[model samples]
Target chain A: MAFTLDEAQRIVSIALNHGRDAGWNPLSAVVLDAGGHPIAFARSDGASPGRYAIAEAKAYGAIMLGMGGRAQMARAEAQAYFMGTVNGVFGGKVLPVPGGVLVRDLDGAVIGAVGVTGDSSDNDAEAACAGITAVGYTPEP
Target chain B: MAFTLDEAQRIVSIALNHGRDAGWNPLSAVVLDAGGHPIAFARSDGASPGRYAIAEAKAYGAIMLGMGGRAQMARAEAQAYFMGTVNGVFGGKVLPVPGGVLVRDLDGAVIGAVGVTGDSSDNDAEAACAGITAVGYTPEP
Candidate 1:
């Protein structure tokens, strides 16, 4: 089943709230549907305008690669040329960095992804995972 | 002053709510800052994947032209060559239609623009104006 708009907005809001509570920098969050189309997005008041694009890229990368951000990072290092070429195919929208977490349903199939930015990459990943779990889905961290 | 993320999200939500209340088709809405940067975006469940780009272009066109969608449309009709050239310069991101409304603050200064899609252009503009008014902002119709 597709993730509803309500679920997508919850993922964005919860991720931003988690970043705030953790005293991280202002954050931006984006939720993409299984088809890699954006369902919801929000940039915190003081976040830079570029944060939204970065956040959206993170989620797009994770969804397109069918792996979590960490795995993508590892692949980027091991197959730099291949990864770079694939990123080029997507018009430089694949950011192989932490903070992109895949959302899975009960059957462990990926349904979508949540991306968070505006903090340390590790912290961003933590917030993304928190949001995914809060929505009763497994976060492929 | 800049629009807070809360206000952007509210505009998106209110516009979608209006569309639903009026039994319009599934809708998509986007809000851009005065600098033409995206602040918030949402697409309803059944909207086509292309809806987001179209909605964003509508708002971007209005913000870039310093006028509402209707004005943009009028100019587009009167100056087809100029409008087409401008669209090419922006990588075809301008949609001269009735669904893009400019948001004005108390001083009659433009703050941002909202774009809505998925229904008829007139209906989309109606919802956009409703959302802007709900937030106590004037909508340049």
Candidate 2:
């Protein structure tokens, strides 16, 4: 089944709250279906205005690559030219950052992705992982 | 208060359902906050792949111009040069069409905008108005 709107909102809520509870900066989170289209999004109070787009782009990247942002970063680092070409094809939607995480269903099929931004990349990734777990999905990364 | 994610999704849900109930084509809807940043989005099943970006651009046009897409289209038709300049300024984010409607709070302050795409422009505008009304917000045009 596709990632439902309720699930997407739950993911965003969990991620943003996790970042707040951890004393990180205000965070923005986006959930995208497997097709790389946004399902839901939220920007926590006080988050920078730009965080919304960044988070959505990160999630889009994860779904487009069928992998987490951390893994994508590693791959891009090893194949810079190929990655640049891929980025151009996506109109720069792919962000090789730590905050984007792939979400898989119980059968281990990638269903969607969660992207968090606002704090350090590591903290953003941590929040995304927390959200994925809260939603009973595997977080790839 | 900013446009919350919940409200954005609610708007999308209502708009999509309205389109479906009317037996229109599958649609994509996007909600942008007052600052013209996307807060949430959804693409209905069977919608053309291009609807998402078009919906976003329509909403961006509505918010940036502080008017509904229909009004913007009217103005654009009257002043093609000025409309071209505006489009250049926004890097083509502005789409002068009937599908984008401004959202306002009870106090009549602009809070966000919603755009619907996939059907005829008139049908899209009707769907957007239904969505805004469903979310207890004013739908301008």
Which stretches of candidate 1 lie above 4 Å from their native place?
none
DockQ per candidate: 0.80, 0.39
* lDDT string, candidate 2, B19-123, tens digits: 999899988888888988877677776675567679988999888889999898898899988877898899888888899999877777889899899899999
Predicted model with the maximum lDDT: 1
What ranges in model 2 sit over 4 Å off? A1-6, A20-23, A64-66, A73-90, A104-110, A134-136, B20-24, B76-89, B104-109, B134-136
**Residue B68 in model 1: lDDT:** 89
**Candidate topping DockQ:** 1
Q: Give the Cα error of residue A19 in candidate 2, in Å.
A: 3.3
TM-score of chain B of 2: 0.94
Candidate 1: the clashing residue pairs are: none
